[model samples]
Target: MAKISLRPLDDRVVVQPQEAEEMTAGGIVLPDAAREKPLRGTIVAVGPGKMLDSGNRGELTVAVGDTVIYGRYGGSDIEVDGKEMKILRESDILAKVL
Candidate 1:
């Protein structure tokens, strides 16, 4: 696949979601209908942080390549070079994966 050139605007981030596991830990294979949409992803691209009312931009805690977990139904899905990606606000991010 070609490199992605898309960059997000202020406070927005472009995430590359992790693929869902086809099989459970118990070795049960799940069908497509039984699989849940992944809420975890790596931060591929990030915006220049949110603009504050004080006229300064707030710093973003997460950087590129950071694996983060977000809300179950957050973000907008986008396709780049045939790869699925998500774009969402920093607020949508729930936790950083260790």
Candidate 2:
């Protein structure tokens, strides 16, 4: 894959979604339409921390290269350099994969 030039702003992050499952546990192949949207992804880019009330930037816990799980319907889908990506607010991320 080509390197993406996108840079998110203000606590937003760019994620490269994991590929959807192609087969079930029973070894049944699933068609594309039957595949579920991926909830897991790797952070490709990160924004500067969000602005805080004290005029200081609040630090974000996640960073580039972090693998995370997000809400099922959170974030906006986008295409960058012909690759599908998601732009999510820091708050939209559910958990960081250990």
Question: Best candidate, TM-score-wise?
Answer: 2
lDDT of each: 0.91, 0.94
Query: TM-scores across all candidates?
Result: 0.92, 0.96
lDDT of 2 by residue, 28-97 (tens): 9999999999999999998998999999888889988899999999999999988899999999999999
List where candidate 1 sits over 4 angstroms from the true fold.
none
Which pairs, if any, clash in model 2? none
Q: Mind giving the per-residue lDDT tens digits that candidate 1 earns over 20-64? A: 889999999999999989989899998998999999999898889
